[model samples]
Target: MSYSIIAAELHKALQDQDTALVETLASELNPADLAQVGHHEPASRMAVLLHCVPLDKRAATLGFLEPQEQLAATAGMPVSELAELVAHMSADERVDYFKQLDRERQQTLLKALPPTVRDDLLKLARHAEGTAGAIMTSAFMAIPAYYSVARAMQTLRLKGADVETIYQVYCIDTSGRFLGTVSLREIILASSENQLAELMTEEVIWVGIDTPQEEVARLIARYDLLALPVLEGERLVGIVTYDDAMDVAEEEATEDMHKGMSIGKIEGGLRSASLLDLYRKRVMWLVLLVFANIFSGAGIAYFEETIEAYIALVFFLPLLVDSGGNAGSQAATLMVRGMATGDVRSRDWARLLGREVFVAAGLGLTMALAVSVVGIFRAGTEIAMVVAMSMVLIVIVGSLIGMILPFILNRLGWDPATASAPLVTSIADASGVLIYFAIATAVLGL
Candidate 1:
C-alpha cells in the first residue's frame, strides 16, 4: 500500500485504540516507511504506535525519525523502556541519539544500559562532530590475523549477526592494531587450511579518527570502497560504511546548494522547518545584498554627466548590467561545484584565470555583437559603439570575478561555496555599472 494510505489507516487505528491493527500495519512497513507514517501522527500517538512494533524494528524505526521527532516520541516513556530501545539501536545511531539527550537523561540512560554498551556509546560520542570518528560505527566485523579461514567462518557464524556488515571484514593483530582487511568472498573461496593473514590484503586504505567527514566521503567515492576503516594511532577504532558516507555527501551538497543561493543552512530541512526558520536562513543574505547594491546606485550617480549628455545610454543600462550579473553567476556556480567535487583546487587558479580570460573575451565579443545591432537601431553609430564596448568590458570583468572568487575564498580558509551566486552577481552589477559608464564617457566623448 502507498505510505499515504497506510498513514491514514495507522492514524485511525491509533485513534480507535486498535492495538492489533496498529501492530499489523506497522509490521507491514519497514523501519523507514514506519518513520514516514509517524510523521503523520502527533508525537504522543507515534510513541504508542512504536510500542506496538516488534522490539527488533522499534529502535530502527526510531532511528529513522528526525532527532527532534525521536526525542518528542520518547518523552515521558519510562527510563527502562528507553534504555531497552536504545540498546537495540546501531552503535553510531545510539551515540547520535545519546548526544541529543540532556545531562540528566544522558546519565540516566547510561546508567540503565549494559556497561559495555554504555562505554562504547561514550567512546563513539566523544569524537568531535563533523569528523570521521563521530560518524564511524564500532559494530564492524574485526577478526585476529592468526585465525584460519575455517576459524574465520566459525567466527562469522557466531558473531556476524551483531555487526553492521559482513561483506568486508577487518583483520587485526594480537595487540588490537590493524593488520589489513579480508573480504567475505575471499574467505569463502579460500581453502580452510589457509590463514587469514595470507588471504588478507596488507595494503589497506584507511583514515584516522579525526579526518573530516567530507574527506572521508571523498575518499570513499574516489576509491569505491564498501567501508573505510578508521584508526586512532595504529589501532583500529571503527569503520565508516558506504551508507554513512552517502549521508555526509548529501548533507554537504545540500549545505552548498543553500549557500549558493546566499541562504544559511536551514535546520531540520525545509519540510519540517518553521516560517521563522525560513526567514532566518534567507533574511541575512537579502539584507546584506541590499547594502551591497548601494555601490551600483553610487556608480550610476557618479556617471550623471555621461547619462545627461546622451540620454540614449539610459536605455541599455538594465540589459548591460543584468548580462554581466548573469555571466558572473554562471562562473561562480561552475567554480563552486568543481571545488566541492575535488576537480578544482586553489592552486589551479592562475591557470584557470588565464583560460577564463580567453574564454570570457570570446563570450564578451559574441555578446557585444548581439547587442550592438539593437544599439544601432535604437540610437545611432556613436551609441552603438559605446554600448558594444561596454558589453565586452563588462562581460569580461564579470566572468573573471565569478571564476576567481571561489579560489580567493578557498585560499583564505573559507568554504569556496560561500562565494555564492547572489554575492557574485551583486559585485558584478556594481562593477558593470562603473565599467559601462567609463566606456561610454570615453567612446561618446561625454
Candidate 2:
C-alpha cells in the first residue's frame, strides 16, 4: 500500500489504542516506507508507534528519519529502550545517533549498554565525521586465513545473520592484522579441503581510518567494490559498504547542486527545510549578486553620450546582456559538474579553455548572424556591423570567463561549485556592457 494509506491506518490504530493492530501494520511496512508513514502522523503518535516495531527495525527506521524527526519520535523514551535500539544499530549509525543526544543523556544511554558495546561505540565515535572510520560498520564478517573452505562456510552459517553484510568476508591473522578478503562465491566453489589463504584474494584494497569519505566513495565506484576495509595501520577496524557509499554520493551531490545555484548548503532535504532556513541559505547570494550588478549600471552610465548619440542601442541592451549571462551560466555549470565527477582537474584547464574558445566562436558566429539581420532591418549597416561584432566579442569573453573562474577557485583551495552560475552571469553582464559600448564607439565612431 502507499505510505499515505499506511499512515491513515496507523493514525486510526493509534487513536483507538489498538496495540496489536499497530504492531501488525508497522511490521508490514519496510523501514524506509515506515519512516515516511511516520512523517504524516503526529509526533506523539509517531513516538508511540516506534515502540511497536522490533528493535532492529526501529533502529533501521530511525536512520531513515530526519534528525529532527528522530529526536521527536524518541522523546520521553526510556533509556533502557534507547540503549537496546542503539545496540541493534550498525556501529556508524549508532555513533551518529548518539552524537545527536546531549552529553548527560548520552552518558545515561551508554551506561545502560553492555560494557563491550559501549567501548566499541566510543572508539567508532572518535573518528572525525566525513572520514572512512566514521562511516564504516564494525559488524563485518572476519575469519582467520587458516580456516578451510568448509570451516569458513560453517562460520558464516553461525555468524552471517548478525552482521550487516556477508557477501565479502575479511581474512585476518591471529594478531588482528588484516590479511586480505575472500568472497562467498569463491568459498562455495572451492574444494572443501582448501584453506582460506588458498582461495582468498590477497591483494586487498583498503583505506586508512582518516581517509575522506568522498575518496572512499570514489574508490568503491572506481573499483566496483561491494565493501572496502578500513584500517588503523595494519589492523582492520571496520568495512564501508556500498550502501553507505551511495549515501555519501547523494549527500555530496545535493550539497554541490545547492552551491552551483548560488544557494548555500542546506541542512536537510527540501521537504524538511523550514521557510527561515530556505531564506537564510538564499539571501546572502541574492544580496551579493545585487552589489555585483552595480558594475553593469556603472558601465552603462560611463557610455551615456554614446547611448544618447545612438538611442537605438538601448533597445538591444537587454538582449545582449541576457545572452552573455546565459552563455556564461552554461559554461560554469559544465565546469562545475566536470570537477565534481573528477573528469576535469586543475592541470586540464588549458585544454578546457581551448575547447571552450572553439565552441564559443561557433556559437557567437551563429548568434551574431541572426542578430545582425535584425540590426540591419531596424537601423542601418554601421549599427548592424557594430551589433554583430559586439555579439561575437561578448559571447567569447563570457564563455572564457565562465570556463576560467572555476579553475581559479579550485586552484585556490575553494569549491569549484562556488563559482556559481549567478556569480558567473553577474560577472559576464558587467563585462558584456563594457565590451558592447566599446565596440559600438569604435564601429559607429560615437
Candidate 3:
C-alpha cells in the first residue's frame, strides 16, 4: 500500500493504543519505508512506531534511518534501552550512533553496554574517521587455514548468521596473520577433504587499517569484491564490506556535489537541513565569491576610458566572461571526477594538462565561433574581432587553469574537490573580462 495509507492506518492504530494491529502492519512493511513513516510522524509517535517492530529488526530499521531520524525516534527513550538497542546494531553503525551522543550520554550508555562490547566500541572509535578501520565491521568470518572444507563449512554454518557477510571467508594462519581468502562457492564445490588453504586464493588483495575510505571504495569497485579484509600489519582486524564501501562512495560523491556548487556539507543533507544551516553552508562560498569579483570590477575600472569610447563593449561583456567560466567549469568537473574515481593521479598532471590543452583549444574555437556571431551582429567587425580573440584566449586560459587547479591542490595535500566550479568560474570571469577589454583596446585602437 501507499505511504499515505500506511501512515493513516498507523496513526489510527497508535491513537487507539492498538499494539497488535501496529505490530502486524509493521511486520509487513520494509524497514526503509517504515523509517520514512517515522520521518513524518512526531518524535514521540516515532518511538511508538519503533516499538511495534521486533527488537532485532528495530535496531536494524533504526540504523537504516538517517541520523536525524534516529535521534528523533530515540529522543526521550531511556538510556538503558537506547544502549541495549545500540548494542544490537552493527559494530560500525553502533559507533556512528554512539559518536552522535553527548559526553554525559555516551558515558551513561558506555556503562550500560557489556564490558566486551564497550571495549569494541572504544577500539573502533579510536580509528580516525573516513578510514577503512573506522568504517569496517569487526564482525567477520575468519577461518583457520588448516581447517578442512567440511570443518570450514560447519564453522561458517555456526558463525555466518552473526557476521556482516559469509560470501568471502578470510583465512588466517596460526599467529593470526592473514593468509588468503576463500569464497563459499569454493568451499561448497570442493571435496570435503580439501583444506581451507587449498581452497583459498593465495593472492589476496587487502588494505591496511588506516587506508582511506575512498581508496577502499575504489578497490572494491575495481575488483568487484564482496568484502575486503582490513589488516593491522599482517593480522586481519576487520572487513570492509561492499555495502559500506558503496555508502562511502555515495557520501563522498554527495559531499563533492555540494562542494562543487560552493556549498559546504549541511548536516542532515539538503532536504532535511535547517534553513539556518542551509544559509551558513551557502553564504560562506557566496561571500568569498563576492570578494573575488572585485578583480573583475577593478579590471573594468582600469579600462574606463576604453569602455566609454566603445560603450557597446559593455553589452557583450557577460557573453565573453561567462563563456570562459562555463568552459573552465566543464574542464574542472572532468578532472575532479577522474581524480575522485582514482582514474587520474597527481603524477598524471602533465598528461592531463596536455590532453586538456587540445580539448580546450577545440572547445575555445567552437565557443568563440558561437559568441562571435553575437559580437558581429551587436557591434560590427572591430568589436567582433576583439570578442572572438578574447573568447579563444580566455576559454583556453580558463580551461587550463581549471584543469590544473585540482592537481595543484592535490599536490599540496588538500582535497582536489576544493577547486570547486564556482571558484573556477569566478576566477575565470575576472580574467576573461581583462582579456576582453585588453584585446578590444589593442585590436580596435579604442
TM-score of each: 0.95, 0.95, 0.94
With a 3 Å backbone cut-off (N, CA, C), the pairs that clash in candidate 2 are none
What's the residue-level lDDT of 333 in candidate 3? 92
Q: Count the backbone clashes (under 3 Å) in each candidate.
A: 0, 0, 0
Candidate 1 lDDT over residue span 129-167, tens digit each = 999999999998999999999999999999999999999
The predicted structure with the larger lDDT, 1 or 2, is 1
Q: Which regions of candidate 1 are displaced past 4 Å?
A: 2-4, 11-17, 274-276
Computed on alpha carbons, the lDDT of every model, listed in order, comes to 0.92, 0.89, 0.88
Task: Using TM-score as the measure, name the better of candidate 2 and candidate 3.
Answer: 2
Tell me the tens digit of each residue's lDDT in model 2 across 40-82: 6777887877889988898898888877778778878899888
Candidate 1, residue 67: lDDT: 79
Error of 3 at 380 (Å): 1.8
What lDDT is obtained when candidate 3 is compared to the true structure? 0.88
